[model samples]
Target: MDLSEILIRPIQTEKADILREKNRTYEFHVRKDANKIDIAKAVESVFNVKVDSVHTVIRKGKAKRLGRFESQYPDRKRAYVTLHSGHKLDIFEGA
Candidate 1:
């Protein structure tokens, strides 16, 4: 898979921010079909950082009802990438 297609976007929630600062971990929204290896490579190429580990989480869509109307949110795949010490992604720095 192409690197651009593998990583969808960076996830910048409060918990992710804390992890980035404390553990050198970064979070990204990845393609649904992407695996750990694909994610690690994509992060390394795009950010120019050495990855120590890659962890993935699949979040299932939740069903919701509003006034007897039922709907479901899209399922999402998240990747947690840990960088080798001394390597930092520019996107996560200075902010």
Candidate 2:
């Protein structure tokens, strides 16, 4: 897959920010079909950082209801990319 297609966007919740600050890890919402290797390469190429490891999680869709109608949110895939020591990505920088 193309690099742009592999990574959807960065996940910038408070928990993700804590992980980034304390563990040298960054979180991203990636394509459902993307794997660890694809994620690692994408992060490296896009951010110019050396990735030490890549961990993925698949979150199942949740059901919802509104006034007798039912629906479900789409499933999502998340990646936790850990960078090598001394390397950091300025993902939150520059606006």
Candidate 3:
């Protein structure tokens, strides 16, 4: 898959923000089929930051029901990208 198809969006919250600022780790919502290398490249391409490592987690979709019907939400993958020293994403810079 293309780099664009690997990364979906950033997850920006107080906890994640703190990690980004202090630990150089950033979180992202990514395609379920995407892996470490694909995720690293996508992060590099999208944020223009050099990635040191990539960790992924496949979050199982939660189950739901509507009376007689039962279904599960779509499972998704999340990536934890570690940036090289002295590099940071621009989006979190001004915040």
lDDT scores in order = 0.91, 0.91, 0.88
Q: Can you tell me which runs of candidate 3 are displaced by over 4 Å?
A: none
Clash list (residue pairs), candidate 1: none
List, residue by residue over 1-95, the lDDT tens digit for candidate 2.
Answer: 69878999999889988898899999999999998999999988988989999999999999999999999999999999999999998866547
For model 1, what is the alpha-carbon lDDT of residue 20?
93
Model 2 lDDT, full chain set: 0.91
Residue pairs with backbone overlap in model 3: none
| lDDT tens per residue, model 3, 4-84 | 877788898898988898889999999888879888888888778899999898899999999999999998888889999
Candidate 1 local accuracy as lDDT? 0.91
Give TM-scores for every candidate, taking all chains together and pairing residue i with residue i.
0.92, 0.92, 0.89
| C-alpha RMSD of each candidate structure in angstroms | 1.2, 1.4, 1.4
Residue pairs that clash (backbone atoms under 3 angstroms), model 2: none
Cα distance off (Å), candidate 1, residue 3: 1.2
